[model samples]
Target chain A: MNTILRYIFLNLFVRLIVNIILGVNVRNRDRLPEVGPAIIIANHNSHLDAMVLITILKQKAMKIVRPVAAMDYFLKNPLLSWFSQKIIRIIPLRRDVKFVKEDMFSDCYDSLKKNEILIFFPEGSRGEPEKISVFKSGISRISEKFPNVPIIPVFMHGLGKALPKGEAILVPFFCDVFVGNSFQWTGDRGSFMDMLGTRMAALEQEGSYL
Target chain B: MPFNIIVCLMGLFVMLSIASTVVFVLKKIKPQKDYKELSHRVKSWWIMIIIFSLAMILSKKVSILFFGFLSFLALKEYLSMIPTRRADHRVLFWAYLSILIQYYWVYSGWYGMFLIFIPLYVFLLLPLRMVLIGQTQGFLNAAGTLHWGLMTTVYSISHVSFFLVMPKIGGLVAGNGGWVLYLVFLTQFNDVAQYITGKTFGKHKIIPKVSPNKTYEGFFGGVIVTCVLAYLIAPILTPLSPIHSIIAGLIISTAGFIGDVVISALKRDLGLKDSGAMLPGHGGILDRIDSLTYTAPLFFHFVRYLYY
Candidate 1:
């Protein structure tokens, strides 16, 4: 039932609103594995990023993918928690550095074991929506734990300007999600995250959608 | 005042029948690569002609709204291909808003506001709104393209639909549908004539830098043929005399040719082969009506100045 609601809300309802508002486009979407336990790493630009991510996913990929959101942000209010639990189907991770480390490891590992495709903003949280911040160490930990899962680097453009940070109303803008090459972890956290960040940035530059 | 819609449709049906037969014989005779494309084009033409005639015959309001929606679609297709910075998005809404305003002028029969609103008034407004957005990067590029996009698609194309509201144009036909029919027929016929002649007899490139397909032989041939068609059909469809219709036909074909080439240039500059891929054989709404963008405003002004 939750999966059906998630599909309806994310795939159908949110996709509709996003298309009507942003006119989203996706390129090289077939690059992602059709049926696999994978981690989606995209540039975090707006509140619209996750929904836009869902909009860009081909139906099968959309069903398995769940955005890994901060527990503090999503699971705080009861209504938001219900929405996050039921419709968005978010894999909530604690953001607090001390308490989050152990809990984050287990929640993510369990989700990956269950074959849920997890979405991560390796930058950890939204920054100055236009700029790609240095990725945090969390993605490295997750990918290191699950060496088989492909870390798919996705780059989305124009959503920062469409919704951005702290903006309640969406301005109509053309947004595109460019799917890039995914690679497996080789135990180096620093260079891997750096390379992943470079790959995501390369996707943006390669798009030439300026 | 009432031109014969039934006769016009019958004429179109006869033309299609002849075209189908010729294509059938040609396909059987020589298995050329162009035959498949030619067959696809002819099939698309049949559908386009029927739907266009139906919309025009429906009602005046329906006809106006139909073209208005078309202009909106053309603009959407044009802008979708052109790259704009993030900051210019807010300004895009206002640019789209001009379509409604431009069409409302057609609806209300307000000529004065219709003439200058998009080109002059909205021209100033779009940039001002962009300036307020505070992004300096690509400011000029964004504003200029949006303004031109609206002007080319909405303001100019509105002239075709504007025929419905012209003071004395209703007296030229039962409804304004015939005037629209006449304009569209000549414009489209010019396109077909150019393509068919260009494919068959074209040797020298007219302006290869812009449009590789346009040939000098095709240009002169299409102009001469479209003019003859206009001269022959004008008395049956529009208010112009044979001599006047010949001149109008010459102007439309020439202007139509220029419009098609200019849009080709736009596509080339943007590194796009076609404006879009919406229509199967036709390309995009912009590709379909690039000539109408020039022909509509030019023909509207010519008729309005002398008659209305």
Candidate 2:
């Protein structure tokens, strides 16, 4: 009951704020998954991107979508820690791991086993708005672990202007999210990364203005 | 009844009637391309204005709360459009939280604390929040942006309410609520005057690259006309000398132009046509209030120095 109320409040809160202030223009919402466990891959540009994705996805899906964020970054303080874990329901992962231990892999595997959608940014960090960076192997690893689950690629544009790197002032701008058709993941390591990168790049190419 | 309050109420009614008539005529002649959308938007505006005008007349507390929420919405829109990295989320949270607290202080009538709330408390809190996140990448930029949004949208806007809460300027006056209304009226009038004059008589663009619609002729003409109106209206709403009323008009008109340009540049950089489509022909809440952002702070400081 509490979760339901929270979701309702969060949905209304985000919609009212975004529509009134941010002027967020959401498109291709039909592409989002109606039901099931899947991987949501998106471009990382602004902090608001996570909120935008969560807000839009919540409108369609029943089960809560969990965003995989860096523990070192989002979980560093009490307020943010609580907000991420409790409100946003983000799963925290250590970014600077020296080696991928069996324990770490199992934790991620366990999240997938729960039949929950997990959002991942293939680029470990935000990159230039004009270009997509070389993706890390996180998506491939998740794909290999959960071959049965669908991998959904999403592309977000205009958040870079909403809050760009090295600029503190937030200039008002419009942003759109495009969710692409999902595909089943194969355990093949090399092909998996290439396919993921290719799909993300295609989304970027289609969405890019310049 | 106090002479100024009675006169101001009469003037407000007359001006509102004129504005309504003009809007109604424009609706008939132009016949909005999207009539349904325009009607929806105008209905919302009527609701908002009715609520706002009632708050102003009925309860000081409600008026303060309404304006505070307006500033909060404006700031939220500004922040949502900017791109902050994951590292800056903590700072963003603090920045938004400060909006609530800043307005609360204004409502509570803590004059001294309200003065330092943003620069002292918020300035210190944002950086500390960033530091706690332990990532210095884009630290300076994120903190600075958060502060800028708060300063303009929250701190600046709260001053309008502050003017209302202030104790009588001298034993002769009870409160400067009239002055608050006067300032808003004059500033918005300057905006309308500039638009009408520029559209009618403007030929030479002031800054073609920045805002092509703005003209030197329109600017000077608008300022002169608004100043005259300010002079005529001041006695009805405020206890200002004619010279002071003229000064107030000049200040609001000139400062309001700067605010418009600043937000215009923001839109240009972002490659956007409108801030949002919340208002038809008016753009978003940010678009409508962009001029207020600058004028509010300046007018507040001016009233504070002279009266308080």
Candidate 3:
């Protein structure tokens, strides 16, 4: 019942915000995975990043798509925690090592085993708006475990300005979402991170006019 | 609601039906060619026409509100495309807010405030707001760009809605709806006419630096076509005589061409193609309404001077 309600609400809310309120230009959207057990890595700036990503996918495919968010932020209050977990369907990960006991990747791995598509923002937290920061190694560690799963790199522009960190009001702005080709696991951590970084940088350049 | 508007809309539907048939036939003839973009454009036109007709037929208030929404979209597109300083976000908020106030003047029929609110009041006040922000590095550029955007997108476009509140003059056959329809239809028609004629017979480039596809052949061809249509439709839709209608067409064509190339120059300066991807194959709200930006204000004042 919760899943059905969440899907229905998100379908309407996201479509209204994305299609009617904002002008979103998506390129190479076909690169998104059709089935599950895949990792979609994108640069994070605004909270709208995940919403925009969710809005762009096919409706059926969107049901299996789950965004990995930090527990400290999204699960702060009781109401927010319930809303984030039930409505947004985020896989909450502990950001603070002091509070975490078991392995953090356990829930992520379990979801992947269930054939769910996971969205990872490798930049541990939202950095300066519109600027890409160095990605943390959480994504590489997870990708190593699921070597066969494809990783799709996406770079989005203008969302940061639309509803950036610390800004609640969403200014209607034209946004661009560029989806790059999917790749599998590289040899080691450094090389895999380098490959992902290069792919994301190249995707960012694709949207740049100047 | 008026009989004249109903007749004009019927004519428009017939014209669109013919266009759809031609596009369908062309696609069947050239199976290998990519008509995806062209088809998308025609499909968008259908949607736009339906929305526009609904707004016009619903009520005067709805028509004004619809144009106000258009102004909002156009301003948002302009703000999104240009580079701005972070300190100017608050000023940008005010810029967006001005659209509501500008359109309110139209809704209330306050001609005095409608004419000078943006030019005299918002113009002076925006710089003051920027000064309060106190980030003086790119101050001049920021002020100039923001004000110019307001003038073009909000102030100029608001004149379109002002047509709704305009008092009907003597000898006018159709209602104010006809005036609005006439201006919008002619502006868009001129754009298509220039594009088609330019593609077919264009050889010498008119302005290679600004817009490469524009040519003298396209310019004169669009003018002649638009003028003839204006002469025919003016009697049915507007109060203009044949000679005045021809002059109105001349103004729209020339100003429409200028508006198109001017926007092209801005995009060239910004190193971008298309303002934004709001409409498939049509670019952005700004791109779709570029000619309207010039035609709306010019035609509004032109008609006001002659009739109202």
Model 2 per-residue lDDT tens digits across residues A4-49 = 6558756787666555446665556777776657778888876777
List model 3 lDDT by residue over B82-124, tens digit each: 9977677678888888988999999999999999999999999
On lDDT, the candidate that comes out on top is 3
B124 Cα displacement, candidate 1 (Å): 3.2
The lDDT of each candidate is 0.81, 0.74, 0.88
Residues B26-110 of candidate 2 have per-residue lDDT tens digits of 7788874445544554555565556656767777888788888778777766765555666664467567678779878888899
User: B135, model 1: CA deviation in Å?
Assistant: 5.4
**Candidate 1 per-residue C-alpha lDDT over A1-210 given as tens digits, one digit per residue, 9 for 90 to 100:** 776777677766787668654566677878865655888899898888988876676777777778888899999999999998778878888888788646566777888898878888988778886778877878888888898899889988777776777766666555667899888897788877778877887898876634
Q: Per model, state how many residue pairs clash.
A: 0, 7, 0
Residues A16-125, model 3: lDDT tens digits: 88877777888999999878999999999989999999889887778998999999899999999998899889999998877545678788999999999999999978
lDDT of 1: 0.81
Ranked by DockQ, the better of candidates 1 and 3 is 3
Candidate 1 has a TM-score of 0.78
| Candidate structures ordered by lDDT, highest first | 3, 1, 2
DockQ winner between candidates 1 and 2:
1
**Candidate 1: stretches off by over 4 Å:** A1-41, A47-49, A56-64, A70-85, A103-108, A123-137, A147-206, B1-62, B80-86, B131-142, B167-174, B232-237, B276-284
